[model samples]
Target chain A: MAVEITVKGEVMTALLSGEIDHHSAAGMREKIDSAIDSNMPSLLVLDFGGVSFMDSSGIGLVMGRYRTLQKLGANLHITGASPQIEKVMKLAGMNRLATIN
Target chain B: MKIVNKFNMSLYARSANEGFARSCISAFASQLDPTLEELNDIKTAVSEAVTNCIVHAYKEKLGKIYITAEIIEGGILRIKIRDTGCGIENIELALTPLYTTVGGERAGLGFAVMQSFMDSIKVSSKVGKGTTVTMKKKISPRITVNG
Candidate 1:
């Protein structure tokens, strides 16, 4: 998996691609958390448009980031999830933790 | 049910193998002519099961993960993932949604995801022996018009 981060004003967007599993998620989490720590943007957006596959590891990634951003007074926004990924996130109650689109 | 086709493989319990396992199972299941959604569901379920073996089963040590995929009668795909590592002490608690023994980035939703995607799932374990997760999903046969 790969993560590309961009910052615009107070918004930071992370564009993730490739299959996300336990192996790949560790790298993604470290990169995103480092960005969040340094930038501390008011909003963090996770773009899943390029992600072809994801399991519950994706949910843990989002939940962890949400918790980190929440402590920093930032909000998390998830977008571009496909139908299948969206279903997994919703089933895990991710909608209540972040803004999913 | 009669078995149409089947394959078995054994791999080391490592995180990197998670993707490899998913790809292998999905490729094997392709003979069923499952839809993209069905294929994705199978891949996701397989990932969760393998992840559990890697993350929880062999947490402190490395072991072997055995997998068997069989296409049975009626367009059903059955997958069994077995680990000879540390087995779960309580199967019921482990299957509960969001209940995880490990802390940090684990959401503990593996079993939940497996149950949601697969038509049926059976998990059996002995604390010292090992754990086995057998999941099955039925792929509806598609109709085609031949000219």
Candidate 2:
């Protein structure tokens, strides 16, 4: 899996690609967290357009990021998630934690 | 249900193998000509089962994870994932949604996801012996239009 970070104004977007499982989630979390720590953006956007597959690990990844951003008093937005990915997120009650589109 | 085709594979219980297990099952289930959603549901269920083996069963140690996939009668697919590692002490508590023993790192949704995606799931484990997760899903038959 790969995570690409792009910043615009107060928004930091992390574009994620490839299959996300337990092994890959750690790296993605690290990259996103480091960016959040360094830039401290007012909003963090996770782009899942390129992600082909995901499981509950994807839910954990999003939950962890939400917690991290919450501590920093930043907002979180998830975009480009396919219907399948969105279903898993919704099953985990992720919609209550962040804005999903 | 009668089995049409089946395959067995064994791999080390590593997080990286989660994808491998999913691919193997997906390829095997493809013979059923499942819809995209059906195929994805099977793959997702397989991923969750394998992840449980790697995370909860084996923990920090490496162990073998055995997977079996069978295409049954009437376009039904059955997958069994077995791990000979530390088994669950309480299956009831483990199956609860959003319950994880590993603290904040894991979402504890593995079994929940499997149960949701598969038509039915059966889990049996012995504290020291190991754990096995068997899941089944029926792929609806698609009607093709003749040209």
Candidate 3:
């Protein structure tokens, strides 16, 4: 339904879990935004270790983060996407937007 | 936890059907602990395909949307999304990467995204009957970084 993120020192790590769809977008957007606003980490890392499903609403989440960091001047990185999730990113031009580690 | 069993939903195939189906996914599949990225992938793929049906098939006419999901053998999740709308006239041409019926010079990545995001994708449609999109995903045995 949503994702969880942990801030470790200067690096904020998000442990994204569960299915993401339109319904969950608002909550996710708020949570991630809060994490960014509260932690103000220099490096933001999204760990997809627990993820099981993703959808277009996922794009809005990623893109929203990318834009947010752009304005704040922070480094963003993504990791642990499933193969199917990874392909969607590639097709959506995610590679060009942020580093997919 | 395992799939337990397949879940199914049927509703009037309207634009709202997209949001309804999407909400159901988040509700039913959250237990697997999908990452934010993973959720995004499924959402994008499903949205594109369902949107295609609403846009191309019904052409504003009311129809029906049927969806079935199963945590198949090997811990894989399989989803069958179907609509009673106009069927694809040419499967080959429609499946062609970067091909679309509208908006030229576009990336034409809707179908491409569906195929790319799902481990296995299947489709069935007949003229005047409508179309069905089958999508599958296999969760990794081990939950490593960036699942």
Give model 3 RMSD, 1 decimal.
8.8
Candidate 1 lDDT by residue in tens digits, B12-123: 9988899999999999999999999999999999999999998899898999999999999999999999999889999999999999999978999999999999999999
Segments in model 2 whose C-alpha atoms lie over 4 Å from true places: none
Q: For residues A16-43, what per-residue lDDT tens digits would candidate 2 score against the true structure?
A: 9998988798999999989998889999
Please identify which of the two predictions, 1 or 3, would achieve the higher DockQ against the true structure.
1
Expressed as tens digits, the lDDT of each residue in B1-147 for candidate 3 is: 465678888877565567667668656555555666556556666777776776677876977778887776566777788888989889878888657676412245667777876687888889899899998876656457885
- Give the CA lDDT, 0 to 100, for residue A52 in model 3: 65
Docking class of 2: high
- TM-score (2 decimals) of chain A in model 3: 0.92
lDDT for each residue of candidate 3 in A5-69, tens digit (9 for 90 to 100): 88788899887876554445557778888989999988888776676665555665787788788
Ranking 2 against 3 by DockQ, winner: 2
Please report the candidate that would top DockQ against the real structure. 1
Q: Cα deviation of A61 in candidate 2 (Å)? A: 0.9
Q: Model 2, A34: alpha-carbon shift in Å?
A: 0.3
Candidate 2 C-alpha lDDT tens digits along B1-147: 799999999999878788888998999988999888888888999999998998889988999999999989998898999999999999999999988999757999998999998999999999999999999998989999999
Off by over 4 Å in 3: A1-89, A92-101, B1-3, B104-107, B143-147
